[model samples]
Target: MVSLKSLFDLSGKKALVTGGSRGLGLQIAEALGEQGAELVLSSRKASDLEKAQAHLAGRGISAKWIAADNSRDDDISRLVDDALGKLGRIDILVNNAGATWGAPTEDHPIDAWDKVMTLNIRSLFLLSQQIGKRSMIPNRYGRIINLASIAGLLGSTSTTQTIAYNTSKGAVVNFTRALAGSWGRYGITVNALAPGMFPSKMTKGTIEQVGMEKLTAGVPLQRIGDEDDLKGAAVLFASEAGKHITGQILCVDGGLTAVLSSS
Candidate 1:
């Protein structure tokens, strides 16, 4: 019989998490670190990354911080190179770096659309491509977990009109499928995690303006997602248990996508 602990253990694996300074990326990094993976975390701000590294170390996890901006090609290249140099290998990659902009369809700025697309879609693909081409492809073993959104799977009734965000996330879903299909034979698995409403720096202001009760009322589970919500799915994908699963979008939304009424 397979021991459950063994199935989830990542004793010697090396993981690189983009945008891991705070919010969902940090949460995912913490989860992966708890599972015994050596982590290389990157984000835009050096100060925030240092603080995050300290926090992870306090939890008894080995972590390294690299200041990187995903929006720039040079920064992304340096990030991958730095991780490879420090960690020796990147067995797992969590492309959780993303950006969002909101505006009415009619008034949305072209620059905002470009920004969202570049960060959320273009950079994600480029980074993943680099990791695969330079590291994972040669090793013939890799696990990639993309941070997609329920916004990609379904439409939202919320007041914010995030047209570019929705479009970018939708692209992410398809990209996961395409990459998974192509890389499966190479012993690589590409998948996506679609999250529902969660409280983070991104949503804090929105929740404050709309109130928690109102937000919770729309979730079928009657609550927003928490840090714990990010752990199980991540462990699944990164562990031996999820080896057979690929090219799929696992929705972590609280039944919000399944049920018509979130009320």
Candidate 2:
């Protein structure tokens, strides 16, 4: 019988997290690292990566970082290679690099749409393929977590105009399911996290613009997510506790998705 501690232990795991310099990515990194997983973090900003590296080290987590723009294929390739070089084999991967453009549907820019799709979906595919082919498939063991959003679960709202972001994440939901089906034969599990409103750099402007109370009023929890809220869910997907779970999107929302919109 597996001990309770053993079920959640991630010691000896080598993990990679994109966009790990800040926001949800950083939070997930902390979760994995705290569970004894050696981590490799990547993002576009070297300064942010440096800070994140220092932050993790300060917490006694062994971490390495790479500066790469996930939207670029060449950079993604380099990132995977460098990550493998640093970690040797990636047992877990967190795809969290994403971009969003908020504009009226009629006025949304084509370039912005392309930008969101490229980072949120295309880059995730490229990195997952590289890592899976190089490590997971051969070893017959891996855990993959994608960062999705509640917007993907529903259509665009009049108040928030992020058509491209919504579409990209909707695609991510299915992508996780489809990939999980293909990779299960190799003992790999793929899952996604659909987080609600959390105060992060990415959502700060939108939260402030819309007002936190207004944004969370529909939620049963009646509050915004704090820094520690996502760590447990993230750890579950990356550890043995979730070994049998795959192709599922776990929403970390404050019961917002459970309630039907009055409209």
Query: TM-scores of the models, in the given order?
Result: 0.96, 0.98
The C-alpha stretches of model 2 lying farther than 4 A from their native spots are 261-263
Please write out the lDDT profile of model 2 over residues 66-115, one tens digit for every residue. Answer: 99999999999999899999999999999999999899999999999999
Alpha-carbon error at 20 in model 2, in Å? 0.4
Return the clash pairs for model 2, or none. Answer: none
- Among all candidates shown, the one with the greatest lDDT: 2
lDDT of 1 by residue, 194-213 (tens): 99888888778778988988
lDDT of 2 at 239: 94
**Which stretches in model 1 have alpha-carbon errors above 4 Å?**
156-158, 261-263
